[model samples]
Target: MEGERAGMKIGINTWAWVAPLTDEELARLAPRIKAWGFDAVELPIQAPGDWDPTVAAELLAGLDLAPAVCAGLLPEHDLLADDEQVVRLTEDFVRHCLRAASQVGADVVAGPLYAPAGRTWLLDADARRATTARLVDRLRPLAAEAAERGVTIALEPLNRFETSLLNTVEQALEVVDGIDGLGLALDTFHLNIEERDLPAAIRTAGDRLAHVQVCGNDRGVPGGDHLDWRAMLAALADIDYAGQLSIESFTAPALAVPMSVWRPLATGPDALAVEGLAFLRGLSAVPSAKNSRS
Candidate 1:
């Protein structure tokens, strides 16, 4: 499968062209995604029943495209909310995501699982400690449940603008520490904004890294920005990360108002996916060349 996929298992998130990916959209995009040489498709679980897992499993199995799930946490689904009902609802939603991932043959459910995107609050030293304790209490059971379902909960650290809970690798590691089924999901976009050294952060994730999201610094096609892709990929190799590097840009209409992605990331979302895939393929060839010479 690695050879057939041109070295690494590259994927594109459905969010690149649509939000809350629908049954109709998945049917439309799955074939084109496979045709574009993506080895996998990342299905974003925005709401339960936005898309059917059984149908998606059948569709993706037929096309031979691997499936992955990205948990989309809305404002109403905050695990750390003061409202107990909100927290309960969040846990229920995540469990649904786990079941959905298992049904769709996805091993990892990746996203900002601690809080909703764009949810920020002042965290003083004492508050930070309290928050970490709260997070562990909230996530420990979910991690156990994920293990039962054969799915890993990959907790992603968003940028400061998007979140205040876990904005760095160290902070994220702290939250998931000692948890059996929890792992880190890193993104180049957030890394570019928050990390002092990109490759170092990737190395820091090491074996706990369950998933990776890649895109240009400006949220365009990767390799179209100034990020050092080769160095980052080398760090992944250093850590022996053999997983998918998913392209995760968003379409203007879907996330422009909130994400500030008013300008076109590429000629179109399709161009962004195709160009990012080509660039990643070129990078994957580098190690092959070195090995051939050796």
Candidate 2:
């Protein structure tokens, strides 16, 4: 609510430029993002040594830009793991991520925090319910910690093949219901892959949605392909979900992540951020002009 713009606020995910970016590089890039009319920047706290949040905070403040923190959970970060040590380490890492997010002045710390990305397996009904229960138990404390830091923990749902746990907004809500300091972070990429109807699914998330990530079906610059972005934005408006619609995509040849996620997203990542900003702004402007006329 604090940083709402006329249209949906557009932002960029640093993962697009992660391989080539250092702390100083992001400092330089933050202002460029702000100048391009982006409302905020989503920084990935992929691992412990990826980037320094102190410097990131200073850079964002200097540019008068807002921040959103994305936590990257690896295979070892399993809340449902039988090993107590594994669960302890994962919870500790999540706490650190929340601290880093607060330090950077991010509104919310969003990611697939329920389990490690790409760590998937088959689950029976009882086992799946147990996993959901474990996730709730694991996240409740983290959610409290986030609230203490004045931030929210946004639980992102991945595709079916990626995780055995919650993979849709409806399922995410069911798991997070009555849990303090937890909300849904919807990604259009996942929605496009899994949802029966994109806009209808978005409306279902409704008031419980905390954050949004947008990209083309092929993970390219939005609007260059065939996504009904206008309808998407209109659905968001109908729900009064005033939050940043950050562009999240990965670049290839780096392979810093797992092999499954290393595929090329677009022709190039160089101009996707700027181009996406322009596209969303254009779509948002149309509604404003029409509203003025009426």
Candidate 3:
């Protein structure tokens, strides 16, 4: 991973192309993604039949591109609910996704797997505590299920606007405290909103950090916004984070409602991915002075 892509696996999520992606679409998209110099592509499995993992596996393999997965936890799929049936159905969904991830040869399935995106409600202190406990109880078995398939369920925490449940790295760490096969998927777009100190929060995630997503603070391409890429890159290096840094963003007309991505974020989706890739690849390209320069 050192030539054009250095010290990191730069990737783009298929959300940059289309949501609820289809095998037909990926069949056309995967090869172009490889030509763009992305080491991996973050495929989203929105539902059971949205795409076929085996088809995706063969397509990605033919192009020599690695594959990773992100799952959309829709409103109905609730692992943190007080109701047992909701939890049961949610666990089944997660297990199905883990199997899909394995079939696609993804080492981890990453996303805000705890609750549905953009679905939030207020919870008082007692309720919050109870909910977290319930979540841990529900997800422990799912974590084991993931391990059995040789994949990890990388839990992502969204902003308060999207989810009040686990908004910060500290909170995500607390929920995954005793879980054996669980990890965190840190996305810079959400971190820009909730975290006061991005670098410190990344360090706090430390080893439990399994995956990373990079984008502008405004959800534009990375390096085109005000985020401190220098410090963020340094922190990731300090923690020895080896997971793929997928460029996650949504296009218009497709995810406008769920993601609120109405306008065009860049000239086009490919432009965003290309610019971000160049910026990220340059993160460790230029070495600082005084290493042995005295």
Candidate 4:
């Protein structure tokens, strides 16, 4: 408490509500999200007008809640595609999302920002380096675009099955090397699958950790599964990561197929989100090696 960031805003992704999000859905969910003690809400940006930033911003402002952007880069929007058209389209989509993020008062446009989710392939050492080089080239001009919009593009590392590239913090850091206005979005679910030492990885990310998405290791409620939340919270405090800890689980129909959600992650999305909030709010009350000193 003495050393942690004074206020750590908690958020729930509208993925918990719906995917291919609509303006109507966001309008309806924002108030309820605000009522649930969330200081912020993360909206999924699928296209230029999928959800109007100006409208969402106004609604959140009325609710006294902050907004954050999560760029929905489906398989169709692959930045690392071999097809030139796909690559160009993906770049445009990212630029569009960056503008939307700016309009919605969010400084970070966050997502994998690479190939489609759940697509994996093998790559040799040379091919891996070449692919990384290609991503850096593609992202360079977009980084400039992001900077213009006062946005930082946070590259998230999905699990190995979801992606073959940038599945670890080290890999993501290398990809964003020499690129300004770019950072890493660490999802604890992915880290649970990929990192040997999750807290060490978080510490290693340190300042480059632009955004954090939290969930249970089993993709359930945060405290309902096996994750070292205490250590993770302390690592966040150590880095002074002044960003919202957004819960990023998916709903049953819209994202369940793609995200591999076979059954209910909770009684419902609201219960899952509410329970996680209670656990995090109680973090400071429980002393551990990570937070006892604080």
Each candidate's TM vs. the true structure? 0.94, 0.90, 0.93, 0.94
Backbone collision tally, model 1: 0
lDDT string, candidate 1, 70-122, tens digits: 98687788888889999999999999999999999999999998788888999
Better of 2 and 3 by TM-score: 3
- Candidate 4, residue 240: Cα displacement in angstroms equals 1.3
Residue lDDT tens for model 4, 1-294: 311353568888988878778889988888888887888888887667888888887888899888889875766788887899998888888988888899889989889887777778899999999999989988989998898888899999988888898899999999776678899999999999999999899988978888889999988888888797877877777677788899888864678887789989989988987897787776763343445565
Predict model 1's lDDT versus the native.
0.87
TM-score of 4: 0.94
Candidate 4 at residue 224, lDDT? Answer: 84
RMSD of each: 2.8, 3.3, 2.7, 2.1
Q: Kindly give the stretch of ten consecutive residues in candidate 2 with the minimal lDDT sum.
A: 284-293
- lDDT of candidate 2 over 4-23, digit per residue (tens): 44345678887777653468
In order, candidate lDDTs are: 0.87, 0.78, 0.84, 0.83
Candidate 4 to native Cα RMSD, angstroms: 2.1
lDDT of 2 at 169: 84
Identify the runs in model 2 with alpha carbons over 4 angstroms from their true place: 1-7, 256-264, 284-294
lDDT of 3 by residue, 1-294 (tens): 122222567789989878779988898888888998889999898889899999888888888888889996877988777788988888888988998999999988998887888778999999889888888888888898888888888889898998989999998998876677799999999999999999899989988988899899879888889998877766776666778899998863578777877677888888988898888877654322222254
Arranged by lDDT with the best first, the candidates are 1, 3, 4, 2
Global lDDT of model 2: 0.78
Name the best candidate (by lDDT). Answer: 1
